[model samples]
Target: MEPRQLRAIMLYEHNLGTSARQTAEKINTAFGQCTIAHSTVSYWFKSFDKGDTSCEDKPRSGRPVVFDEDLLRSHLERHPDATTRDLEKELGYDHSTIIRHLHAMGYHKIMSRWTPHALTDSERAARVTICESLLLQPHRQDFLRSIVTVDESWVHYNNKTRQAYWVLRGERAPTEPKGYWELLDEKQTINATICGEQLEKLAPEIATKRPKRLSVSLLQDNARPHTAKSVRHILEKLNWTVVPHPPYSPDIAPSDYLQIIRTHLGKELVIYDDHTYYCNVTSANGWKKYWRCTRGGGTRCCAARLHLSPDYKVMKIINEHRHPPPRFIVRNGVYTKIG
Candidate 1:
């Protein structure tokens, strides 16, 4: 039989107050074993709840309306967590229509996946920095195995095969799953004291595994326990170089690459001499920019800034800085600050 005819029967059974599973079984018995699924019956019942009795698809309007796909994509890129209702309010479109278009464009909402930590903006920004400093090192390609690595696992009280962790009658955490995965023993927290201890001989094992290359780079989280002075002291004594961090810090050098490349991302950014500036639009092909000093507004550098034309061949810088010059690397012709 046609699916629509079966759905009509399901709807009839639903109106008669039949259970979805029972209705499905009755239909399958008359037709064949798997002719209709209980879930399909439940779906029709839901549609019935919404007062939608039609078994056929909704008709398309005279001309299919076009959604501003670019606008939708742009909004989604900015606010990924936005829902259909949010989009409807922002873009002045029907939520259902927007959802249909979204599906048509192969976009679907999904539950946010769990991460070890939901880091703050600064933490995320700190993780986002870029630098070519590593490229300056020699033979980095050959040193992959020389990086210190270790695994962390729970060590049971008794050295028997721990088939499954059983929670020994303790208050379960609010978000704890009521499953066999619950810890049987009171789980021990790895504090600074324990972190520095004999965890698979982190330092000694690395040295023993790699006798020739004693020096190894250690990548670790910027946690107090992980970066304890005592821990660092012992690791450094063994010539273990800690991967001291753009991953662990929010401070940026090569000065705010994101802000520096603002213009590349379609933003008009005017920056020079390690300072952000706004352009004086009335100026010629050479943009006249205002210099922001340490002093509060309205004050300019003793020597006003200038954006010279390419036609000008020779230019001389005569002014001296107030303090010692910052460390910078000359790229092409522009000086980029090093962090």
Candidate 2:
């Protein structure tokens, strides 16, 4: 029997003028177990005598209140990125105390670094309108399968910058010359026509890799070259459908690689080259897998590990390689330093 039931029995026996020892003995005989001690019975009898009938534990004392909720909330509203130690110093409270109150107030630190360009009211409305229209389409999945999202970046040569490093006590710090610029002739910007031609060649390769049929949906931002009449004509003649994208909305475009990884959730199949890596049963319950670069250890092995979901979607990557791959040597046919 529970302690509360025993207490109830003790109260009843006490009302009948039975002593604490007799009540305890009667409880033990009735239950066929010596659950309640004479001391426990006497304690409950005294509580009942004093008009206290509740069986639950009383409220504990010395509950911590290190920081004011209103003050912390107001301060965080102004500076949301403040650290726990920073808050501790500002509020003149212990670090643990500050942390406790922060958790109590339902505040957590997250990486909220902004990546998208600032959008105006009209731009935001345009994105919503375009999204709604796309959702209403009958063949959304087919459209997505055909998308060949393209973006360009300028590759620089010999652009190493100096960084701080640990040095010996007597040694002088190494230096690199700053403010050097690459010549215009050294840089080449790709236009939409060149991108379209590349897509036409790549479509067959993509089809062989992907399970679905290849339909070219060329997705690009509102760059002058991308929206050019000549580029449009070339793509249309090649049977590629150009998806309409709102200006200043890189987050909505598949070309924004970071945005896609951050927003994607649930089951997704990711293929690397011709290999399809399913989730190994050795993985934990969570949706994360750590696959090594090479199956077996070797001298020229890559330390790089791919982080993916259970269904094989690439999430994050740890590319801190200790040694170059054997293929890298074969490509150059010579050993070279990689930056």
Candidate 3:
């Protein structure tokens, strides 16, 4: 039997007013190989006599105790970004003890929210004005259904960050220096033309999947290519309503806030019909494969590349193209870009 079980039996004997020696004799008679020392029973009997009912051993004097909430709160106020490990070092407590106390105190670590750019007072006012105008539109739900948001981002040729790993003593941990310029993959900037035209082209198919009364309202940042005359002309011809947005407010933009493109790319294998894709040798690492466009004589195609995981899930589609997909392919009653 375990020490706890033996202690429980001792407590029961004490409740009956049995002496410590009598309890020890009864324990030896009931459980073989559990011959507890007589002195141990005497110690427990003393505790039970004093109204201690717990069967578990008492905490040792040297064992770590729960952290002070006031002290922890003050420390966090000074170092809001300090990690749990950092707190352990500073407060001289185990990681688990700190975590338990934090839970009891209702403290939780939260990541800082990311914003595309810090908004000035003027920008904030503009955002509010645009939002108020949008809300004032007669057909608000219809407008929302018609809104097609778009944004552009650079896709790095190589992973910008490296992961840490365990290593044996005397063996150095692997290191990939950020300053190794050659190790960095080429960066590509995509334009908004492709996104606008593709949405226009896909309108009929997208409509078939939804209610027929919906119209598309294009939402895009004020990037150069997005505001270009040619892009606006195409949007007008397609009859897409353009939604006004403030500069550098990606946090409010549906495309950035909802992460539509990122989620779409991460879930499926996507191919563009108009753009020819070639395997990029520079990014054929085990975790990801990169494919670049072959348009524009290798210089001018939408600077985007498709990143795929080993299992063929599209991790990301980097950059934007200045042109639309050359053609749409209809297969099995579904219109899809070429894969």
Candidate 4:
């Protein structure tokens, strides 16, 4: 008999002190060792009396497990960030049911969200080749003059977007709906390119003098609109250089440069669904007032200057700081920092 079967038989005889028929049932329930049938188990004892030891128990049967511990562990190790929902969908199982099973099996998702991006070895190699093919152009004056910084900003109305709650003692706070954006009139602005044309319209004097005209490289995100055929053709015709900012790098943007400016300007200029002033608040017409200016087509002059002390020289420090602290020491604390 195999060692495992022999052990099973010996355990049954020693522990239960019962016959093989009841022993097999106890083994199946206690150890999930369901290979031996009642008849086979009985025969084993009878044959043992005759000194004919043998291996006869067949393996268990089922629908066939698709994922064993090794396979599941491999998947989980490769996708550490995968959520229960993600694992359930990918492995073809009911989420709650899987969750219950995983709980019983002592497994848990490491993260709340996980969306795997599948790319083959060849595909990754091809991507590397394509990325390398993006040849860097030589530095030129024209490129510098053409550069424009494109970015996005959100505007909220009613009240500034903040999280807070009104609650009674021992009572849960009122919760806000996720579809608040649809309830209110919010605008998403995609500010593209602060170019010569834009600057000219923005500040006539600066445009007239050309401000030491040299080619400026345009700064933009990886949005398709930035590299659209029409946009590219326009930039090409103007001989403007286009350069993309690193993806998700806020340090390169003016917003980060003027972080205080944004904080100070907060709800005074911007609005959102979280605005307390707008909570369950609607315009008199029950709709947001739309203006052509809000559409972001024409140029508008905003003569806001960087908040610096009068004695502070703009050019004295080539790169004063990536981010300047709020003008705490300036204006004798009487005047706030400029936007």
The reply for model 2, stretches above 4 Å from the true place, is 1-66, 153-186, 196-215, 258-339
> Comparing 1 and 3 by lDDT, which wins?
3
Q: Which stretches of candidate 4 lie over 4 Å from their true place?
A: 1-72, 75-135, 140-146, 154-210, 221-239, 244-261, 265-339
The residue-level lDDT of candidate 1 at 111 comes to 23
Off by over 4 Å in 3: 1-67, 151-189, 192-216, 236-239, 257-339
RMSD of each: 24.8, 17.4, 17.0, 17.8
1-339 per-residue lDDT for model 3 (tens digits): 788988888988898989998888888887754588789999999888888889987867452565577888888767765677888888878888887777676664422222445668998899899988988999688787777766543222332333322222233333232311111123633456665566666677667876575567888878787887888888788777889988776646655432212222232223432233555544435544777655556555456577766655456765344343333332222333333
What are the lDDT scores of the predictions, listed in order?
A: 0.52, 0.57, 0.61, 0.41
Measured by TM-score, the strongest candidate is 2
| lDDT value for model 3 | 0.61
Candidate 2, pairs of clashing residues = 146-215, 146-217
Q: Residue 18 in model 3: shift from native, Å?
A: 52
On residues 1-339, what C-alpha lDDT tens digit does candidate 4 reach at each position? 354665556555744557777777876776567556777667667766666554445456442345454544566667644566776767766666556655555553211111112446775575456335433445445554445565433222232222322112233322222211112124632323423344335334434556676454656555565666666766776566666454433333443222211233242111111111111222475432221111122353211122222222122211111111111211111212323
Cα-lDDT of candidate 1: 0.52
CA lDDT, candidate 4, residue 201: 51
Candidates by TM-score, descending order:
2, 3, 1, 4
TM-score of 1: 0.35
Write candidate 1's Cα lDDT for 1-339 as tens digits: 997898789889989999998999999999999898889889888999899999985676443366787888888777766777788888877878888777777664432211224457876665654335555557877555565543232111221221111111221211111111112225865556666675325667666777788568765555576678877766766666765455433223222111222332343333333333333343464533332222124342433233423432113222222222223333222333444
